[model samples]
Target: MPALFVTGTGTDIGKTYVSCALIRALKTRGAVVDAFKPVVSGFDPKDAAGSDPARLAAALGDPGGVFRIAPRRYLAPLSPNIAARLEGETLVLDDMVIDAMARAAEVRDGLLLVEGAGGVMSPLTDGETNLDMIATVGAPVLLVAGSYLGTISHVLTALVALRAANARVAAVVMSQSLDAPDLNQTAQALIPFLQGAPLFLAPRGESWDAGALADHLLTDLRAP
Candidate 1:
């Protein structure tokens, strides 16, 4: 199956939201898209499951669950390494890579979207970072940056890290994670801010449809 991995400059930058939107968008095109959060930190009291995998699975409508795709889940609301330590499981880099590839293969004809935990260099294990994790996965990256203060630096810094790690970059996605008083001002600066990568605004809330977001992504994915 064709696949792309989504990474972000930092946490809470709307990676899951954008990822969900992408999966939902692709599904609209009659594409069976599978999403994976290789390592999730936060816990949801409802599931007693302190992980993003469950949330991502629900968002993607994964009836079988994210465990079908993700092999590890840590419970602490911290970096993966810290979370792993707190939860008593070692974050095995090789295992994660193997599982993700296997999951992508499971959906052989579909588009698989894998989302990384936290920022590129955020720790996944005692000695490994998300960048190292991405290296293991070896898939193209769809970098997500929030549309807020210092985003430009974060985006470029992430792009530099991706390049340093030799990860194929699919594109940079500037997400709307805040309610700016002047949406237009933010929109106008995105093109230049992203250093030529196409910028798409993710509308607020699940109430909004995913059309515009999908269209922007499709255009990027189709670009040479």
Candidate 2:
């Protein structure tokens, strides 16, 4: 099975949004898709309806459950390591890798989308970051960024870190942020810094559609 690891410059940067849209787009192209958010913090099992995992399940048209989508859930809205420690738990990188592999196997020949928690350097366990997870999974990346001030620096920094880890960035998506600069201008500004990766602008508000973004992504993925 093939997978795309969806990561971001930082949290709240629309990783889930872009991922959901990508799943929809892939499905529209007759691709069977499944999504995963391996480690999720700020989760309340009592109110799983509002969590990222639940939202991803909904996006996959499987709103009935979330545990299958995100196996690890922590209560605190902090980094995974701290959150796990707060609950007297520890996250093992190998266990996470095994879980991801198992889930990927379930997807079989379909596309398995893995949504990383927070930024690339966000700690997963004591010494493991999301970057480590990406490396362990050996999946190409779909880096997501926000159209906010100083976003270019964050995006570039993440790109450098990922490159250092030998991760392949398939594309970059600049998601529109509230009260932020113009998305088009933001994307244009990033063009020079993007090296050769394709740059996409995801507009804010009513005009946003995951299927449309997926079309662009599929086109790129199919390109030689």
Candidate 3:
């Protein structure tokens, strides 16, 4: 099965939401799809149990076995490096990437959706960023662009970074849950702005449907 890395223009840009949607969609297509969100920074004491990885686990029906499903939870809600520092931990890029890749290998025959922390340039360590992690995985990226004003610039900027890093652009999905004022016009313009790079719009409160969403993903991945 092909692997995909889901990232976004910035944090809270709906990367996790889209990741879950893809996992659900892959399941619908009769594929054994699994996800891994390595290096999540930011923790809410109140949400001691509401971690992104934990939430992802829940989204995937909380399957057993930690090899391929565990989310590498980091406590700071900040960038990985900052969070690591705050939590008295060091950001080990090699170790973290290796661990994530090992898990992805375990599910070699299944689609693996690896979600990145923060935006493309968010620092992961003293000198590293999510860009390095994406290179290590070497999977095509599916950038999640939140549907908001000025998204075009954000998307374009992110696209440039992804291309610079030699990461393949599977497609861009515009998440409509970001509370934008002019949702319609923004969504309408995204299509032509992307210029043939297929774009999909997701509305708020949308039921997480794997089957329906899979079609859109397949089109973006161009997988038969």
Which residue ranges in model 1 land beyond 4 Å of their true spot?
Answer: 44-51, 63-66, 179-181, 193-195, 212-224
Name the candidate that leads on lDDT.
2
* Candidate 2 regions with alpha-carbon error over 4 angstroms: 219-224
TM-score of 1: 0.86
- Per residue, candidate 3 scores C-alpha lDDT tens digits across 45-148 of 46645666766776678744232454455656678788778777888888868877787787767767888888888887888888888987788888888877
In model 2, what is the error at residue 223, expressed in angstroms?
Answer: 7.2
* Candidate no. 2 TM-score: 0.94
Candidate 2: clashing residue pairs, number = 0
CA error at residue 214 for candidate 2, angstroms: 2.3
The top-ranked prediction according to TM-score is 2
lDDT (Cα atoms) of all candidates against the true structure: 0.74, 0.86, 0.74
| lDDT of residue 35 for candidate 2 | 91
